[model samples]
Target: MEPRFLLMADVAEQLNVSASQVYHMVRSGELPAIKIGGRGQWRIERSKLEEYIERKYAETAEWVRTNPLVEKDDPDLS
Candidate 1:
């Protein structure tokens, strides 16, 4: 049996983006998906979606680490 897949609208709702953005991701291969029929039907695996989110968070964390934030005001010396 084939694994379940999510529709573009549903995926966008979950990701808080527009369906067009999802389509862009599909085109760029950032989000793994399979198209069915000639009507541009796109489907994504649940596991792949979760993995993508995790990887994005990891990249964000690494960026913050490499570029640390600084306070404008200096604290009192102890």
Candidate 2:
């Protein structure tokens, strides 16, 4: 079975972003994570990652709803 927790690198790979970005997310409290060991390594729960993705999807949908696309032929472009 897959592990319940994932390393920062793993989360970055899944999200197609850099490891530092994941670290920033963790630091900024945008993503939930736990630090373990004497060295204090960060580990994110798989469920929390899933939740973040779902929340981003919802936010994007809302943004799209509020900001409709503008056509190239629209008079505002001229």
Candidate 3:
């Protein structure tokens, strides 16, 4: 079974982002985390990561709904 909490580096590896990005996310309150140990090591809960992913999906869906497709010369836009 996976640990309930993971090191910041572990979370970064799982998310495929830089460890610094994870730290920034934690600092910015975009991702929930806890600092433990005398050196203030950061740990991210698995559930919080799942919650973050869900929130992103919801945000993206809302954005797509608010901004419908528009005619553009760029084929990628379609």
Candidate 4:
């Protein structure tokens, strides 16, 4: 295997967003990350990224359950 973890730019491309956005996600704790350098070089595992996405959707569902207004106002459901 080349490497299990991916660099910031690679992860951003994989998610189809800017690297700065990815960094923001990491900072916000939306995505799992690891720092490698003194300058705060961050990397994320591919598997962890997938798991993060799943967890995000799951959390959204849970939030809708507890916050019924969101589900009620979501026009896309009907």
Flag regions of model 2 displaced more than 4 Å.
73-78
On a 0 to 100 scale, what is the lDDT of residue 76 in model 2?
Answer: 80
lDDT of each: 0.87, 0.98, 0.93, 0.88
lDDT (Cα, 0-100) at 33 in candidate 1: 94
Residue 76 error, candidate 1, Å:
22
lDDT of 3 at 18: 100
**Predicted candidate 3 versus true structure: per-residue lDDT over 1-78, tens digit per residue:** 989999989989988999999999999999999999999999999999999989989999999999887769559967
3 versus 4: better lDDT goes to = 3
Q: Could you give candidate 1's per-residue lDDT for residues 1-78 as a string of tens digits?
A: 745788888889999999999999988999899988988788988888888899999999999999866665436432
- How many backbone collisions does model 4 have? 0
Q: Judged by lDDT relative to the true structure, which candidate is superior, 1 or 4? A: 4
Give the candidate order by descending TM-score: 2, 3, 1, 4
lDDT, candidate 2, residue 25?
A: 100
Clashing pairs for model 1 are none
- lDDT for model 2, on a 0 to 1 scale? 0.98
Q: Which runs of model 1 end up more than 4 angstroms from their true locations?
A: 1-3, 73-78
Q: Which stretches of candidate 4 lie over 4 Å from their true place?
A: 57-78
Name the lDDT value of residue 12 in candidate 2.
100
Q: What TM-score against the true fold does each predicted structure earn?
A: 0.80, 0.91, 0.87, 0.65
